[model samples]
Target: MKDGWIVNRAGLINFWYYDDEVFEFMDGRLLIRGANGSGKSVTMQSFIPLLLDGNKSPERLDPFGSRARKLEDYLLGEEALSQTNERTGYIYMEFKKQNTKNYLTIGMGLRARRGQPMDSWGFTLLDGRRVG
Candidate 1:
């Protein structure tokens, strides 16, 4: 979604270690609330492998953001899924940078399949005059 952070969905893995469920993300943030061992930590751990090599740390406890896992699960589809949930929707994120009093928008809308690899896609920049 962005350079330093990402926003996406929550992925679910079946008892067999296969991803079987995905919670569609409407907003970029999620508040995981459930009893202990209800998959909150596991959901967070799923994002670790996506960070830059050194960005990952063994001491880190929870990766509670939507980006990595959602992207991973989408890009790595069926291969990552024992069963896919077609009802799932796309997870979208936009990276922002603060400049003085304004915020500048950077990357946007990175999509991935339930169990496939992250998609390599880019956006087109529009000219200011005629495109309105």
Candidate 2:
């Protein structure tokens, strides 16, 4: 069996946020603070549980447990906010082994283009393969 991994950090690129954002975990827990419409939920949900299992079903993407929202909404936004019809984004989690420099990295690469279905891929880097 492979070594156990503990989450160290997660982040987003070009999804919801125009700028890259990183969420660092303290003992596998995260506490975030921000005003309404600030994108806190989208930031966390993009990684947690999703990274753990690589399931991006609508049920898992929405924190409210509603099937109304879609991951595409985060990548390309609504008709008004989107600057381009096509775009690519990423969500990643960095994991570290207990008391060691070893790591395991997992993530998803997502692309959305108008008049087309979303294209995506999932990956894992193990045996001390860090995100660096």
Candidate 3:
């Protein structure tokens, strides 16, 4: 970790929709410019999942009581699971560690049953590689 070890980009694959979306941090800021109901809040929420510690009380994460109880819940949606294929969705984040020579990629794969919690999600951390 370094001073410039910050999130530079993010991607979501079939987490909410069947398509994939990617975003890049520009000018050292992430600006979600969109109209209402355009997933601004959801996109913003996606950035915090990796930093969350589920073992701790979720009071800070769910202070509003109606936001989200878990990180997967934030990513889960009505059609989060794929109906046409066996592939589950995933969320990816890229961080520029220290300098430009090395980077860190953190990924969270999500899978859920119709009436069950999304406890099947997987988290992975890769060093010195970039995954997109």
Highest lDDT: give the candidate number: 2
Task: Report the lDDT tens digits of candidate 1 across residue range 15-130.
Answer: 11433455444335667688976766655554434221222222342345433333333324444443543322222122222221222222222344553443433232232111
Expressed as tens digits, the lDDT of each residue in 67-92 for candidate 2 is: 88677877888767767788898888
| Superposition TM-score, candidate 2 onto the true structure | 0.84
Q: What is the lDDT, from 0 to 100, of the residue 46 in candidate 1?
A: 42
lDDT of 1: 0.36
Candidate models: Cα lDDT each: 0.36, 0.79, 0.58
The numbered model that scores best in TM-score is 2
Worst 10 residues of 1 by lDDT: 123-132
Name the Cα RMSD for model 1.
10.2
lDDT (C-alpha) at residue 55 in model 2: 79
Q: How do the residues 10-121 of candidate 3 rate in per-residue lDDT, one tens digit apiece?
A: 8887665436888888534588888977777656555464434322133344434344354444444434542432346777777775556556777777665545655445
Off by over 4 Å in 1: 1-6, 10-18, 48-132
Between which residue pairs do clashes occur in model 3?
none
- Tell me each candidate's RMSD, in Å, in order: 10.2, 2.9, 4.5
Better of 1 and 2 by lDDT: 2
